[model samples]
Target: MNSDEIKTGEERPTRNKWNLILGILFLAYGSYRLYQKLQIPDDDNFGMILAVGFIFFGIYDLWKYYKGV
Candidate 1:
């Protein structure tokens, strides 16, 4: 209750914004990688896997943001 004391975590306002931000970033990066994969012929599929993974996580983050969890 002291004037100089900082607010506790529970007393602070919630700002759950990183989820949306990371979601957008991840989606963009995934889409770009996917496009590159489609444009190029490669012997390795690892890049494709990574691209899909990014897309999946992106969607999950977006979902979390919307669900307010």
Candidate 2:
């Protein structure tokens, strides 16, 4: 394709709707899980680790959306 035919900027599609939705869901769930863990006396390392992972993944997905990736 010719350079003149190439698309750029606004011509490109924005982030997928589903991606944003999933990211938001993940963030909310992870935050809630973390809070619940903190409220209880039980100290489960695995739960905390998973919660942190989900939170980070959600953050990453949101960041990707902003970065237009």
Candidate 3:
């Protein structure tokens, strides 16, 4: 394809709405995991860590959306 066509076909990251939806989903999943961890009788250190990581990633996505980066 020509350069102009290629440039036109390329999507700007900030224009993608799925990023925001995915971020919200990640946040929700993290919260759900945390709740599950709390309900478990045994120690859930791994679950807690994973939940924290998910939450952080979600927040970072949100930040990126806001910053348009």
Candidate 4:
């Protein structure tokens, strides 16, 4: 194969559809859970903390996709 036949890095890469879908799903679910958790009066509940973690993870995933990283 000739060198010219190889693809160059000049072309823009396509993002995965699944990544976008999962990111949105995670973000939405986490937000919803967080809202629910906040309504509870229990201070010992760790649900909110876990929910926030999910939200951050989702945000990071979305950011990676958006930045083409």
Write down the lDDT of every candidate, Cα atoms only: 0.86, 0.83, 0.80, 0.83
lDDT of 3 at 13: 61
Alpha-carbon shift of residue 65 in model 4 (angstroms):
1.4
Per-residue C-alpha lDDT of model 1 across residues 1-20, encoded as one tens digit per residue: 78659755655434469999
Candidate 2 backbone collisions, by pair: none
Query: Each model's number of backbone clashes?
Result: 0, 0, 0, 0
- Cα lDDT tens digits for candidate 4, 23-42: 89889999999998888887
Give the TM-score (vs. native) of candidate 2: 0.77
Candidate 2 lDDT over 6-52, as tens digits, reads 86765654876666877888899899999999999887999998998
Please state the error at residue 51 of candidate 2 in Å: 0.7
List residue ranges in candidate 1 displaced over 4 A: 1-15
Error of 4 at 5 (Å): 10
lDDT, candidate 1, at 29: 98
**Window of ten residues with lowest summed lDDT in model 2:** 9-18
- Give candidate 2 regions above 4 Å deviation: 1-13
**Model 3: per-residue Cα lDDT at residue 69:** 77
lDDT of 1 at 62: 89
TM-score list, all predictions: 0.76, 0.77, 0.71, 0.75
Query: Could you list the CA RMSD of all candidates, in the order they appear?
Result: 6.0, 2.9, 6.0, 2.9
Pairing residues by index, what is the TM-score of model 1? 0.76
Instruction: List the pairs of residues colliding in candidate 4.
Output: none
Which is the better candidate, 3 or 4, if ranked by TM-score?
A: 4
